[model samples]
Target chain A: MSRLFRLYEKKRGGRRTGSKTVGSFGEALFFGIFFVVGCGTMAYMLVALAWPEWRANRQFEETTCVLVGKRVGSKETAEGEPVQFRPEFALKYEAAGRAREADGVYDVTNLYSSDEAGVKSVIEQFEVGKKYPCWYDPLDPQRVVLVRGYSLWLYVSLLIPLSFIVIGGGRMIYELAHWNASEERRSVLDSAAAVDWFEAEAGERHFPNVPDGSNQTNSPGTKLAYRLPISATFGWTLFAAMAACILWNALVAGFVVMVVRDIALGEPDWVMALTLLPFAAGGVWLIVYFSRQILVATGVGPTRLEISDHPLVPGMPYEVFLSQAGRLNMRSLEVWLACDERATYHQGTDTRTEIRRVYEYRCFVREDFEIPQGLPFESRCQVQVPEGAMHSFLAIYNEVSWKLIVRGHVKGRPKFEREFQIVVHPALAGQLVS
Target chain B: MMDPRLSLMLDEPQRTFRPGELLAGQFFLEGVRPEEIRAVEVSVLWHTEGKGDEDMAVHFFERIDPDLDDVVDLRQPRRLSTVLPNSPLSYHGQIVKIRWCVRVRAFFWHGKELAAEVPFQLGAVPRPQEAPV
Candidate 1:
């Protein structure tokens, strides 16, 4: 029985303590969201491309015109002069009462004449015989033009915004999957250990804290573990938003296509709901997203540090003190000093120290040695602190400032940097000048 | 040695024409180099100041010679006169002298090489009158 139990323990040990099933589910969910959003965006673009043709075929008619006359001279002067003249073929159409009413009455009268003399003058100036392309509805043969073509650029321009939605949605889904998988594994391990007699024999079995399991090294809960759900929520919200946007775009395209088809079929007066509704909604969403991001960035509290008031001369031992001032604690903090090229360090005195202040989430301690005669009065010194650490140093040295560098991942969010300057007083200058 | 360039002096008709009226002018070209010139083509080009350091306008070529000789190398000043726009110019009965300059180019070797160009302003012409109703 002892040997059999040993074999069983070995076999159980080989099995991963975490739940593989949960991890897989999380990964599948992530990939599913990514695929749906990406494909939807591509479909929206393709629908937009076909929209113009759908509109054109539904309303306008094809017609023909003969070159009457050329628009001569500069664009400015060509207006008063007959820009184009109706050819003889157009005369036949005019005789047959086929001339369409010119669209803008005022511009037509001011720019082109309607009288026979004007027509004759235009025809005389015409290259005599040239065929021009025009479009008109068969029902109303009067509408015609010297130029006709569909502008394809309108539909092509939709790709830019669609691409952004796809990229942002894909990245969010990836992060969500990673968080979900890790959470599942953690729960599985906790359950497996709880079932083991040896682990449960003690009042509380203490397992090595998994990386990103919980904030407290001693406790089972950690900030990293809690952040997984938060990340998932954010990812799902973004995915839903992207899906809605794609649907809104597709609906708008369909509506435009329907309206165009109606107009082409000669239902010119058919009124459809203004398609601008979706565009307006999209604009509002963009504004909200931007404002939310800005608010989050500003609400992350400032970094604070403490510094001792003393002259830091080259080749001298100066005790530069540091501490945090804000409620938030930082993961890492650092300081760097630079002096003139001719400066030299004192033997065994040039050293850098980093101290993770115990129990001080908002505070840390560090000590650095000043190279003897290493820095001159005119030289520059720089102090750098990572994001989330509060600095009291910016207040002490009037000339020196705290510059925040990289803010590490906390809630799957990026780090930010800020700089503050401290001033050195005239009284303290003499100590360092010597 | 004289440079192979042409200089011109233009004089406009004493009156201006209406909006659709055509204006006429006389332009004379004098050769700086004593070289033979085959044929001379006159054109009325519009002129305007461009944004940068240049001028912008169009040149409307109007042939004055109905029968331009194949070649006539000239060492002395020559004179020819004809209508402003004929079949070759093809800009007849149209306004060509709005803010205009008369440019004359001497063609040589069956129109292979242009010997010289002479440009001169035609002071504003009288606007054409409306025919009595």
Candidate 2:
């Protein structure tokens, strides 16, 4: 029995420990929140998208009538004579029930009459007939539309929300995968460390012993075995929610297009409401889903790199310590030096493309860097510090906080690291006189 | 000697308008105090810089009768506008103050065989119709 137990123990010990066991609970929770939020957001967007149409229609119904008018002159040029231009009509109409009267009546003229030729030529390319179509409410007859079935703004409005969903969804997925990998790695490291300490203690070797109560392993598997499944479920749920949002947005857009087409074709009012209802519902769903996700998944914090001091001197190098406070990790870090303020700093695929007129340097910190020998206090250090500090002791300062940009895996999980500032005082020039 | 002076000024020069609208302001005569003012003619002119050496000029002339009311006629004015040679109308609104303006492009020039181009501005305003009650 003893031999079998020892063999079993040996086999278990040989097995790689500290392999990260992703707590599905966190992931599941994250995804659940994400899914709900994404769907809610999508639904909200759908509603928002439909709002303008609804509002406009409501206003149309409330208002008495629309004004209608047309340009009267012939746009075409005559054979031999110069184009006989007809001046535009200027008419004034006042709103009823307003106490104050309008100041004065005037005739408006087009200053760029010469550019009419250019405008006409451009319009001709679109195969638009010479007859400019217009509309006004039948009841009021004063409100008007200059060109019928012509709306270029709709395309832009539709594209904005669609773009947001696509980009946001893609980012969320990438984050999930990255987060899973990181968690796995962390678990593996923790388990390995625990096993190593256990073996060292059993051997009773003189190698410095782990301090009492200070040797606790940071392992999710040991702490919460059920977390993985929960996390996975949550993650999948969130993904589904996000997908739903995108789908809802698409549906709303399609509905809007259809409604607009119907209106242009002079469709019945009954058909308009029936066609628009589904879009409105989808929009409402998106809002609910997004709001829920945002509320529940608010725990995801930011990545912060804290530096102990500023204005690192020429002779002294500061020690930079790195750790994580939130639910994420920084996978890469870098440091750079540049004298010009406009120097571009690129990390991975991201580019800082702006003209900054001042002293600047770019440092990439995926993890952290600690210089045992302090950084030298010199002019190079001045590149990172303000001009006032240039004359004082050397300081290493960051212009912007460490951005919580997740390269891969888990969204909204906060990761934090800190760096210490080491100031090197200037060397004395001569002996002191007391 | 009469100093061969030329000047221009507009009463209430700035005003706003809606689409298909017309603006009217009065031109004033200042620093003239001349012995005998013969004929005051105001020419509505459009000026732009010409390529290289030649300065381009296009103008329409209106004889301002000081005795007559400053009423602007949009459709038909007194005469076909003409551009003057050699002098090219020495009064740009920049220097002289001897002319008065009226509705759109009516100006007052008072001198013998003398012609002056007066500056006038016309603008178009867009009219968006409001929903009826």
Candidate 3:
């Protein structure tokens, strides 16, 4: 069982020290339990509810039976519960060259009603000593029913347990496939190998570790070879904020409606009402916050950055064009060439990522910058990659990246920073410095 | 009889090489019967290590099935080689490190498997220290 699904595997580096940690086995177990229970209950419900309907309609023998007597029968369902009534009849039929007498129920569902009048109305459809068509179990002539069909309520109720099965089974399979498997194992399964079958080809002068820069280099620039793509645009941020605000308020509105309905019934739920106050306040704050973001995004207009070359190398100089369009007064505007190191780690079950700026060089700085409504601010800055700067590195859990940032402080408005990502290739051997 | 053992050896004693340099290695099995071998897999790869999940990329890979090849011998040493790429030099950082290794795994017909690895350095990049904030 451990081989099939590992609850704990030997930690990679910790193997030498003989340490262990909880593995995907724990996750698989959790989902596996849900899968088993859901399937069991669903199977039981299907066999109990659907099997009889199917048998009555498709497999049971249809025959004519004389209703000797019909009456509205009542039975106590449970303690303190009202009595339930159903239409029943004494059935007489001939099957397999033999006469049989049986008590006939109205339907396979055995549905009962609290009102005796409803049951009497159903029995009125048939008269005593009249022949009526009914279905009898072929294997047992004594088992019979007056009606045969599916119950919509029972079938619809299956969806609840079905959802659990889908979620649990799907996640269980995924966890089993990825549990403790290394990246190479995954790549192998994906058939990502490109080298020669026997060995790596000679003189293959490619930097496989360097990230591709085609995303930034695809668009042609008016004055340069490539236009660097912004990491995050103000418009996208504003849209995300607006979406969050709408979704949050929509959820809060549902709870408020529930509370208001309870109050209208004169049985107000004070605990629920008190719990909704903080959520209602949060929705109001989100609305206000999103409104301010909208104003700033509209006032900021757009920012564009273009670079002369891509896949930059250390000890190289490049030209960058910066443009800002808006009607705004700025205290200062600065462009910085920066490199950041990022690492992601797991703490218990929580995953977190931390980033730190490892290198930064001032490219251009201007004071008392202003932009008129019709006139846009445009400038070019000469940026140099630091000689000893580490090239951009990317792995599953760590990364080193370079970027160009534009910081603008608008008078009487919040300062905004726009970032443009760039890739840096490994420096030449001679350029390396200690 | 001694337990089955797998040994891996790098051509370079120091196991250090520059980017775009050739990396060669070999592996041998001992205390294992030849008929018990099912297949062998060899790879030169780099993987990340530290506080986070490890990521790996294979530079070269090959598999040999002794049952399919009439001339293949599981008892003899097998050679493997590859040319390293010019980026992602072996790094020893505060939170993350990249390590290069030549790994050989052998599958036995009895449902047992053995693995051996020899670590090597890809570049001479100095260990990095966090810059003062």
Candidate 4:
């Protein structure tokens, strides 16, 4: 177990997690077994089906056989299971200048079925004492077959082991490639995402980790160069709540049906009815929660933010246009420029993520505002990315991001917050104030 | 047997550099015969450390194989140079720290390996402190 943990740690980029030893060992053991079973099954299939099929087609010699007898042969598959039937024919053929008699097989892979009638239909194909073309093993004349074709089951059975091999072998190779790899080496090996791209035409480095601002830039703003997209629209949250409510109530309905049926039969299961009380209450709570989400979704309106220029750099001033649409009285509406650093790490068997706000600046704030229907509250503000601040950074398990947050406290409604993501680039040496 | 000695040297004495500046270095191998050397890889890269899983990117990389480049002696100092990238300049954060380094790795006979790296500061970005709630 210790050895497996050591191997797993190396494969995990050498990050030592002593607390997660047991979990890592279990994962390692599962993959190890999966790989071994895959290889073993593949070897078994090669010997049982593939090799014999190849020999039957290549090494067996064609001969003529006279069918002397036919019968529905039944063999017990296992204890407590029904017997399976296969058609068998007594064949007499001449091989190696000698007459030999043997039982003829159907194909390279034998077919067995629980339906005896199906086996009888196959046996009825040929008449007794009739000479039919057959193939005989050159090495063993006793082994003869009337049919020498591949079975459909042969291909179907191979898919099972092949699936195992693909999954197991692919995982093993991935782990081995990452073994003892440095951070840079592993990053290069992560072929799913390219690390970075250097622009030869403009002599600039494009960091792949930074979120692309093309979507925000493509839509030209009415007052600014670009309109920033809102992160996480409320419609999705409402939809998710509705889905959960439906699923939970549907499950509770099943239990209700069972309890009602028991009561109708005059055998009320009090224990079962008592056990379902909490779940029934949970279903009711979900419906109420979903209804509240719907109300919230309908009440809140669209919020828009436009920036004068995209791909903002530190220490530079830029113009921002904000628009809020709704028929409501707001106590306060504020827009904040914020940067957060997020980190993810494994703790025992669980993964925990932490985010810290490293910097925040209030770009715009309005107190005690009102907006009537068909009219939106609009304002413009000037904001600057702080100097010596970290630009937007992203890695597999860490991220530093910048965003504009709009917070509103409306009278007689729940407080709301909306975020618009933004990208910040590193300031050039000349741009950084001393 | 004792392991072979590997060393890396950078041209900048203080090991501090700004973005878009030329970062030049070289590596040397000692106490091992040249015939026993298989290959040498020198790279200039930056990687993240601290609480999260490390992430890295290679600004430049070069591999010197004794068999492929026949005339080269393994012990001779080989030059490594590249213009550093502009972004991701060596940040030291609370839960995550981005670091830049030049690494030299040597593969010897019998599947033995040795590596050395020299750390450097990039872009003079001050350490960030978390904003109070």
Best by TM-score: 4
User: Which candidate number maximizes DockQ?
Assistant: 4
What is the TM-score of candidate 4? 0.75
Q: Provide the lowest-lDDT 10-residue window in model 2 chain A.
A: A393-402
Q: Against the unseen true structure, what C-alpha lDDT does each candidate score?
A: 0.35, 0.33, 0.79, 0.80
Reference-based lDDT, residue B84, model 1: 29
Pairs in steric clash, model 4: none
> Could you give candidate 1's per-residue lDDT for residues A10-103 as a string of tens digits?
1121132334444455555665666666667667655654443443455545444554434321122345763442323231123134454333
lDDT of 4 by residue, A1-434 (tens): 66444433432543554424354345556766787898899898888878888888889999898889988887877789989988888888899899998863666666577998888888899899898999888887778888776666777888888877788777766666665554455655673343335533232436545666666788889989999988875667778889999999999999999999999999999999999999999999999888767655678678899999989888888999999998978899999999888988776678888988777889889999798898999999997887777888877888998999988888877778888889988888677655
Report the lDDT of model 2 for residue A166: 61
- DockQ scores for all the models shown? 0.00, 0.00, 0.37, 0.38
Evaluate model 3 with DockQ and give the value: 0.37
In candidate 1, position A341 carries an lDDT of 8
Sliding window of 10 residues with minimal summed lDDT for model 3 chain A = A14-23
Q: Write the per-residue lDDT of candidate 3 for residues A271-318, one digit (tens) a residue.
A: 999999999999999998898787677778687889988888777888
Model 2 agreement with the true structure over A64-83: per-residue lDDT tens digits: 11222223243556577555
lDDT of 3 by residue, B1-133 (tens): 7899998898899999988888987788899988889878888888877755666777787878788877676567878788778878787765667888888888888867788888898876554443322
* Best candidate according to lDDT: 4
Which residue segments of model 3 deviate by more than 4 Å? A1-51, A64-101, A109-133, A150-229, A233-298, A308-318, A383-396, A423-434, B1-6, B12-22, B30-41, B58-75, B83-89, B92-94, B105-115, B122-133
